[model samples]
Target: MTKKLFYNDAYQTSFDTQVVKNDKDEEGRDYVVLEETAFYPTGGGQPFDEGTLNEIRVDNVEEVDGEVRHYVAEPLDASTVNGVVDWARRFDHMQQHSGQHILSAIMQDEFGMATLSFHLGAEIVSIDLDATDLTEETLEKAEERVNEVIRDNRPIETKWMTVDESNQYPLRKKLAVDEAVRLVVIPDVDYNGCGGTHPRSTGEVQMIKLLGWSRQKKIVRLEFVCGNRVLEQLGNKHKVLNGIKGLMKRPEEALEQEVSSFIKESKQKDKQLAEQMAQLLEYEARDLASTAGEAAGVPVIERVYENRTIKTLQDLGKKIVEQTPSGIVVLVSEQKDQLQYVLAQGANCSGNMKEAAEKVMPLIEAKGGGKPNFVQGGGTKAIAADAFAERLREAALETVE
Candidate 1:
């Protein structure tokens, strides 16, 4: 069995070890197993260790049937070699995993809930609780209790005991022991049989935060951070609130009411602005009717707008086609990352609008349409404004023919 260095020190980043087993696999390539390792193998929903083994890249690390297997980029000599663990990633994992244990233990104790699932993701760590109806008050209480445990500076103890001995204690999880069960005890808070790495003491956790909670299918999902992550999250929130305060020309504390009022006022003003804009477009449509010409007695008018929303373009095209006698108006607009078009035909156009859109849209990889009177769509392909404009013109002319 390999000596787990991380078990002794969660902060251990560097170590030197002797290559205990050195050999090749089925492909006849060389590999080496160290007598001791600081690497934390991928386990308990936490990611694997990432670092260098004798300057060789440690690509993957895993524990298989009681052995920690380190997959390296290349083989090393079967002698003494240096191993370095990525401190940032390792520490982050420690914070997240340890925080999870404390949080899970508290939930089980306080609410009579079990931790159904736990995940240490790149963005955040989440724990699913078996209980439901967790209020803000309960969450705040849980956070306070966990932080109180951290402040108490209780000694964390780990022991290898038999299954029968472990069953006698108030363990959070069932002990899985063939010969021995490794139990991590957090003073009076938690006692769980686990192989995961943890901090030496409760105070080493630094902080425990309850980010938020969501309920799904009778389980309450908790999202939170611990240790340095709490500090990082605070820093990010501070920066964002500062920027928002500057934009609103108000102090950060005054933002909640100010933002609320501003949004309400802005919505009212937008409604008025939309009404006026629609009226102006109607006037423009009438003016556009003069330029509508006929090909085989079916009038056609093409209009271009700088940048407009798809709804606005569709409304304008429908209005123009309704006002004109026999005209087919094609309106095109190019917005960021998209090209939009609306085609509306009055009583004069002889062909179907949906059929026209179907035939022409596939050419530009676009999607959308309506009945014989109106059709609207945008190109899915990332096309330049000029290229999309050209394609729109081609599609319009095909409809006219």
Candidate 2:
């Protein structure tokens, strides 16, 4: 087994160890096993430590079969080498891990909510509690209790004991392992089995802030930040708020109301614009109907539009048929790489619009369906839009016969 230097001192950043084993995996990635290491492997919802091992970058660290394997970019030349852990990352993990213990303890003690699981993520940490709901008041009270413990700077002690010996302390949870149990104790408060590294005192966590909570799988999942992460999150939020204030030309205090009003006004303008656009399409459809050509004693209004939406074509077809009672409207439009068309006959007309659409749709490899009076479809732009519109006109005239 590799001697875990991190267990001895969570603050240890540098260490001297011998590379006892150097090997490559099936994928040809190089990994070295050190006789002793301060680099903590990922475990207990805590991530692995990253840093340099003898001037070579260690990409990942994992404990496999009781050995800490440091996956590095290159193998070390000498057996005796120095290992350096990334202090910022190490300290951050320590803060969040220890903070979770305190917060989880308070949640159980105050609200009788037990922490079901935990996750230490890249940007934030979260704990799954056995409670169904977590209110704002409960979160506030838990935060207060957690910070009180931090302010008091209570000593965090660790002890190795057999499974039976651990029962003497007031353990918040049961031990998962039967032998060689490591218990982290907060005097007169919490004792639990954990292998993750933590600071010597609660004050090292600095503070624990509960961001929010949501229900997941019948449990309350609480998202929170600790120590330096709290400051980082605050800085990011302030930056975003300042940017919004500048864009809106409003003071910080008035930004919320200003943005809400802006959204309301923008929606009103959109509604008005849509009304005007409908009026314009109606006028255009009437003009097309007035210039319709006679085919088989029926008015045929055929037109092709550039870059028009399929909905616009459908609306134009509806309006043209309304204006010309015996009219057949064949409207085609090119949108991007495809050609879309709408075929419709006035209510007074006897032509089968569905039959006309069926005949022309196969010619252009199109797909659509409708009743006997109206049909709409689209297909590849293999032919020009005007040519496609002309073909549709012929099909409608054929249906009249």
Candidate 3:
């Protein structure tokens, strides 16, 4: 079994070890075992360590039982070696993981919720807690407690004990142990059996944040960041807000009120313009229907217009049918990318407009339906307006005649 130097001391930056085995196998060449290693293995939802052993780089690290297996990309001389840990990556992991530990502890202490899962992805870190709603007051309380633990600067302790001895101590979860169990204790704040690298003291965590939470099956998933990540997020937020203010021609401090007022004014103008447009459409529809002449006792209004939507065509059809309560009114409108068909009949209409619409609609690959008198539906640009109108005229004549 390879000795785990990281479990004993997280702050250990360098170590000296004798190479036990070296060979050139399928994966080029690499040393098999080192007497000591500061590289933490990939376990406990944390990533593996990466650094250099002498001049050769350590590519990957893994753990089995208590042995740490280092996978090197190349072979180094079979002699004594010096190993150096990537302090930057190691420190980032330490800060993020330690911050998570404190946040988890506070959630359990305050709300009796257990952490279901945790992930440290490339862009964000999140924790899933087994609870539903959490009040704003509770959030503040939990945040305060976590930050207090960090400020306490308690020395983080790691110790190895027998399975039976480890069972005596209170743990956040049950101990899954066989031989010696490694316990990481944050003094009075937390004590859990973990096999991961951690900060020397709680103060090194720097900061803890509970950004937001979302509901899952029966749990709340939380997104948060700490230390350098928190600083980076805040910096990005400031840059975005400054850009928005410049685009709107407003001071950053007044952005919220300015946006709100602008939205309200825009909506009011839109409503007024809609009313005026409706009046103009009614007048236009009357003029077009007059040109179509009257059929039987009612006016057979059939006309096409551009730059009109399905809703506008239907609205104008309804207005014309109400005004000339004698015959059928058919309106066809085509916009840049779509076509619409609307057929409206007065109460004294001779034929069933609904049946006429259904029979005529399918010929154009469109849809049509009505309340026994008025029928309306539309289709894509492929549907020809003239073909649809002629078919409707034939159906209407059969019903009305």
Candidates in order: C-alpha RMSD to true structure = 4.3, 4.4, 7.7
- For candidate 3, give the lDDT of residue 42: 83
Residue-by-residue lDDT tens digits, candidate 3, 1-401: 66777777787879999887665446464545777778888878788778988867888776654556677777677678899999888888888888888888889977798887887755467888989877788888888898899899988888889878877777888877788888888876778888777888988888777787778888888888877788888899899998889889998779999989999999999999998998998897677656655656556888776767778888888887776677788877776766687888866676788878777776667876777678888876676666667677667656674
**What TM-score does structure 2 among the candidates reach?**
0.79
User: Per TM-score, what order, best first?
Assistant: 1, 2, 3
Give model 1's TM-score versus the native structure: 0.80
lDDT (Cα, 0-100) at 275 in candidate 3: 87
Q: Which stretches of candidate 2 lie over 4 Å from their true place?
A: 74-78, 278-401
Q: Write the number of the candidate with greater TM-score, choosing between 2 and 3.
A: 2
Over the stretch 342-397, how does candidate 2's per-residue lDDT look in tens digits? 99999999889899888888767898888889999999898888988988888888
What lDDT tens digits, residue by residue, belong to model 1 across residues 95-132? 77878888898888987879988898876889998877
Worst 10 residues of 1 by lDDT: 388-397
Among the numbered candidates, top TM-score falls to: 1
Q: Weakest 10 consecutive residues, lDDT, candidate 2?
A: 73-82
Give candidate 1's whole-model lDDT. Answer: 0.80
Better of 2 and 3 by lDDT: 2
